[model samples]
Target: MKATKRQYAYYTGMFMILVVALYGIFLLTGKSFIWEGDGLAQHYPILEKFYTWLHQGSLTGWSWDLGLGADKLTTFSYYVLGDPFSYLIAFFPKGRLELGYNLLILLRLYASGLAFLFFARQRSFKPASQLVGTLAYTFAGYSLYVSIRHPFFLLPMILFPLLAYGIDHVLSGKSWIPLAIFTGLALISN
Candidate 1:
């Protein structure tokens, strides 16, 4: 028997609900309160330094003495560009940055799921095939591994399918500059 449209929507909704519940459980059981590795906190100094820079107009980097000769400030320099996300994080109350980061994780997971669904639709998969494809991506091994490691890396993975779809739309000559800028912003946003 073929699944009706309502049945498919029900299945998709249930799957999304389950994904969110699983993500919450996963967040609760992680090694650290925020699930980001030790290297994540290494940016704290830079965060403080950025707040100082905002008020003082200093041009120096986070710290010349912080890390090893070459590797010390490399990670912090990732934010040296005008990305305001970190600044936003720093603006919140001192103890609430973890909450902010946790919200970012949830958003990343949702975006990853949507990206998988877009990919499945692009492939014209049958309902079951699409379900499998979405599940494969949204719950893949890398998801588990990344949860314990550099969790933010998921942002790029989440944007991959959507960016591909937009680029394809542009290359088909239906549109150009919008997709180009969209993809470029996705790259820069990370």
Candidate 2:
């Protein structure tokens, strides 16, 4: 189904509204979204170090910070190297990393919804049903759990629907490029 621009806008806006509704309390109270567990201990610190390295213009060298000095790229590749959204950290000011981190979580959730919408459209689902599926997929238990506990995991979740759609296209005898691209992205991201 060819989605109109208006439909795209509607889906995007709805996703934004849902995300804000679900997470607005943090914004309202000026509370950090960093979870008390892995989010605080692992993810935020990695992001901060990444931001620092990015600003320092040296993301490929050894770092004394990683347990008595380790290879920066190899050490962080599993965490942030391949995730495209991680690069956005460079744009956030040093003092506003908490905000950036929270915003990135929200952005990932929003993008996951949109990715699901795209897949649903590819399956020729009705517009209304697409919205429903998108919301359900975005707010699924696993997604919500990982959003805070392990934000990077959301990347794979977001890619899964799109990968499925790519597979469908390939099975329909369409060009295999979409499948290859999404597969490559999934592999690179993780």
Best by TM-score: 2
Per residue, candidate 2 scores C-alpha lDDT tens digits across 106-158 of: 88988898788888887767878888888889988998889988999899878
Score candidate 2 by lDDT: 0.88
- For model 1, the local distance difference test gives 0.59
By summed lDDT, the worst window of 10 consecutive residues in model 2 runs over: 1-10
Q: Any runs in candidate 1 off by more than 4 Å, and if so which?
A: 1-16, 19-75, 79-92, 127-132, 171-173
What are the lDDT figures for the candidates, one per model? Answer: 0.59, 0.88
Candidate 1 lDDT score at position 153: 62
TM-score for each predicted model, relative to the true structure = 0.61, 0.94
Model 2 TM-score on a 0 to 1 scale: 0.94
> What is the Cα-based lDDT of residue 69 in candidate 2?
95
